[model samples]
Target chain A: MEEIRAEFSRIYDTYNGKIYRFIYLKVESREVAEDLASEVFLDAWKAFQKGQNPEPKIKNVQAYLYQIARNAVSDHHTSKKFKTVSVEGHMDIQDTGDPVEEQAAISIEIERVRGVLKTLKDEYQDLIIWKYLDELTYPEIAQITGKTEDTLRVNMHRAMQALKGRLEPGVTPEPVLGT
Target chain B: MREKDIIAKFTILKQIEPRQEWVRLTKQRIMGVPIHERFGFIDIVSYPSFFRISNLSYLVRKPAFALAAFILLLAGGVALQVTNQKLQNGLSLAEEEYQDTLASLELAQAQLQELRVAVEDNDTEKVSLAVKSFEERNAQASKDFVKLVENSSKKALQAGMKLVQLQKEKSQLERVLGTTLGEEKNEELENATKTLIEQELSDLENRTLTEEQQQLFAEAKAAYDDADYATALEKVWMLSQ
Candidate 1:
């Protein structure tokens, strides 16, 4: 029992931030994201307890947490209770004590990027968030999404292309940003 | 914006964090207790709502409780088997009664047809014998049908009532034919019987019938061609809504 609690605490402390960020990006309300993020942990705890008794233990807890967060978000969307809150309000753009004009310009720029991201398909949105925003590697994304590494690379390339097209229409090709 | 700039901006979005209060409360709520102490048998007994039947691992570790649980489960299984056997027997008896009723109804229909032919031919002796046989078969079929309806489930009740109505119509037709024959084999009576058969056939066709009913419709048509109008009428009544 003490071993199980220790394992759970380690997993929760390590992945809670990433899971919260992943859910917060997909959902509109911070409150909903917080609730769903907490639910993901509770579900993982219950499943971990069950696995401790007569079931094969989960090998990849990080991937498992992402899977739970994905299902929670999918359920939220399927319920059709979606509400799109203002992205500018939730984003805590670092306050370096900049001028008011510079801060306003940065906020507008962030809002424009968020609007373009929202226009993309859900798969593309997920790929961009996991790869670019969260900085997850292709193999890690593959583990979370249950896809092969080659498939993830191809999908990520397509997602980046789509995002580029949405962000800058009629622009000439430039070198790809990241490996 | 450059691709690097766009990626940088998107990554910055991850800096947003949930409030500290929410994080603290959610962590406390999820991982406040140690694992074994969380859902113990004492906790389950104290808070019945938290007791999940799947959490009987501790009971399985004790040999006496495990053996008692196995015996209880086995006894419950045996009891279920016994109840199922009784239900199967009842269903078989009802099925047999339903078959007997169907056979008697068919025999009554045959006798009724013979009576109709006898009436058409002005043969009083054959008509008398046919009437007696038809009455006996019809009475038996009605009794068996009632038994089937009483013994069977509610789903069979509607079909059983329809069979009862068909029997009543057949008896009415028999009475009309008897009265018509007692007076004379008039053209009016023959035409009346023909019109009645046609009306009943149209009614049967309008209904949303099953495959068995479509076959019965074809059989009724054959009976009509053989001048067995009584059997055709019985088939049509049997197909009623």
Candidate 2:
């Protein structure tokens, strides 16, 4: 019992901040992310209590958290009654990047992309956000979204082109992927 | 860079600042729970990673999760080592303090015995004015005994205070120092001065002496109080012999 407590304590000490940041970045809702993060650890604790070695089961608790977070967001979407509301009311877009000019330009570009993201279908948005925004590999996306990696790859490519075509004429954003 | 690569890197950079309040709330929420509560039969049944997320493409993509886990494990190892050292040092100091207290108590008892015996032996004329010397020594021993008792009690009280103080310090240090012993060791060193004081103070509480010494003190005190300077001088000389 003591050993388990020590183990969790060590895990918490190490990854608490990082996991929270990951969750926050995804849900963009402090309340929902906080609730889901607790659920994540509570689930971890339950696994530990059942005599499972967490180190083997969860390769990375942080990634696992992001996985949970994505589901939580989807769940929120499914469970809600209202329209898809952006959690951007409290978001300070200005704080997204470094103060350097290049970074500032990138930040503006990302915000522009995000603005365009809202126009895509929810599934397309999920793939684009997970691939480009969340930075998950195809497998991680497959794991989170229940999609095959091949399908995810094709969807991602199509999503990017669709997004690029939707960009106002002459913006001609560069290709997202190299051939 | 391709727009996709730019977007990917841009996303990562956007995440760097991370909403502080969100992170704080999440940490507070999940950090307290144990690790096992995280898994559920439902999660296993719904294991997206097993069926839904698997693909050959995953084999080709870089393994970010594996890298993150390795880094966290490394950090955890260093932290554990540092904390272990500090806890060991604290325990060692506590053991030393216990030993020092025992030694001081024994020394106090021994000196008290010698003073008592000197009083009992009525050898003043032969031994540099025995009665006056014995009386002076007896008074000094009594004062020392009182001081020993006072100092011991004081130290005991101080230890209690120290325990509270250390606990508070430990909690605070856990913040700035973190769980690793490396950060905490410096704080321990600073706090060590207090531990030494407690050690010196505790020794006065338990100075051990033989029954013979007790008898000598009792007899000498009785003789001295009764004003039997001659009889006291006799017992004093006998003990010395």
What would the per-residue lDDT of candidate 2 be over residues A66-154, giving only the tens digit for each residue?
A: 56655665676577642354454332233322322344455455555545554566677667656665566888777766679998888
Model 2 lDDT tens row, B119-196: 356333322333233323333333332233233433333333323333343344335422311121222222333333
Most lDDT-accurate candidate: 1
Q: Please give the CA lDDT of all the candidate structures.
A: 0.65, 0.48
The DockQ value obtained for model 2 is 0.06
Clashing pairs in 1: none
Please give the distance, in angstroms, between residue B113's alpha carbon in candidate 2 and its true position after superposition.
72
Candidate 1 residue-wise lDDT, B135-233, digit = tens: 566556555554554455332433344444555556566576633211112222234344555655776778877899999898877887887655665
Error of 2 at B166 (Å): 34
Mind giving the per-residue lDDT tens digits that candidate 1 earns over A56-164? 4898888899899999999987875554534325443454344334555665665566666666666777778888877888888888888898887787776666656
Q: To one decimal, what is the Cα RMSD in angstroms of model 2 from the true structure?
A: 28.1
The local lDDT score (0 to 100) that residue B208 gets in candidate 1 is 77
